[model samples]
Target: MSSTILPVSELTPSAAASEAEDSGGKHPFLVALGQRVRDIRARRGMSRKALALATDVSERHLANLEYGVGNASVLVLLQVAVALKCSLAELLGDPTTQSPEWLMIREMLENRDEATLRRAREAIGELLGSGSAKASARSRRGSRVALIGLRGAGKTTLGSMLAEDLGFPFVELSREIEKFAGCTISEIQGLYGQNAYRRYERRAIEEAIQIYPEAIIATPGGLVSDPASFNLLLGHCTTVWLRALPEDHMARVAAQGDMRPMAGNKEAMDDLKTILAGRAAFYSKAEFQLDTSRQPLQPTFLALREMVRNALQMDQTEHAE
Candidate 1:
């Protein structure tokens, strides 16, 4: 099987053809579905050829599906999801209403407005003992502060300073993942594949949440790609999205001298922007957002510190006060 390649002229999804299928002038749903397919595949570090062979899907079919012009049947999608180790509903960008309880819950909440749905979620969380009044109290103390963003968003440097000011431990979840897997991230993916690496990631995050009562934690950018881990982070932590312009993100990562996988790729910047855009929707789920590209390190850190302190209901002084 050859690599799945979309011709240069057809780099983006085929809007006209998709619309014709609408038999719809455009198929944003299928476009998004295709994007999810590509995103999950990339996260797993599996080449198109690998996925094609693994699923016994023809390379041409996979490429067309990815380019958003091919309307694959349910069976084809099932095979792709199985090979990618993700749920079929996830691949199709639909909420999983498989279980009876889930279907019942969906029925109860269906067609509700956003505000109503939010209240319903809060009610459910409280009932489950997960997001009750105690959770609010925990948030006031800043029990868990998780910073999420792409690689060059200053999670490491800013997380360290925030932890120091708050007098709490700082945990880098990526390093913890490596510890749990007993290998580097690349090696974990290479040796056991993305699914195993995701297991390690889930374990590492769960451990961090369990062992640390109050701390600042920096997370992997791709953590958002794994639904389970992202949900755990969201349910347990006060998440902040540190955003930067595409150029700034690239430059910052380069300045750190750790371009490991992206060093020589001519299209690295374009690829970076596409990944950032794809994950931006997920990243925006954070409780707060800070634009790190707006200022220098000190100023940006100061702003972040203030924003976090405000969220924690802390006074303007350091924890020592």
Candidate 2:
């Protein structure tokens, strides 16, 4: 059971040219598909050879896939997706973009700038009754402030302080998750695995949202790993990214006596950086972010307090010195 990709048989230049000609002007769909495959592979931290082994698909076919010349059969595509641990839809994109009007609209929006795309997303959300128009956005956002970021970013401490100041209940979601599973996080993951742990995590969040309207919630660092749960938090709470420097993160985690990451693992810093980079885009989706490393805890708390109060439209003069 070796997880090794067999050697790939190279295609001749004439054969490549024939593939090009047969694809009818480079096959726009498959070209985008190949690019998508490459991007997903990178994000998943899998080398092309690794992916080939995981899928049990030939390296030559995967090479064709990356080259945008592979007319992959349904079975082959399914195997690759299963190996990649993502749905075929996610890897290939929504299959519903088939109609002429749908294709044209999609094409038009595909090249628009981020700002334009964001505005379009907002509009679509509103029209679909899932956006800000459906609720008093400020009230909803102000009531629930969810802290997100790396584990050592002071989410627990800050969440408690902010909650007490706002007279809202403070919920450390990780604790609730453990309660739901009837074991510690390490035990949950070790015994049942990550998938089971994520299920517990999702349920914990759902229950938190349903039961507590006015609360300051400190979420697990990896909550963003599950898009459904992350989207739920985004829709229901005012999310904040509690940022810290890489050195600060390590120091803080070590100070807390959690040496799991750094214990005998010399590449811990590099791994931490990679995790940060991979999840940075998702963290940036937070409505607000504060860098805790720039100032002392008290000042950082004060700044966070100010930001949250303003976001929730609470009394600013109460804590004024």
Any runs in candidate 1 off by more than 4 Å, and if so which? 1-95, 107-119, 131-142, 260-266, 314-321
Decoy 2 TM-score against native:
0.65
Best by TM-score: 2
Per-residue accuracy of model 1 over 220-303 as CA lDDT, tens digit each: 999999977886787778789999998888888878887753765768878898999999988987889999999999999999
Off by over 4 Å in 2: 1-109, 131-136, 139-142, 264-266, 314-321
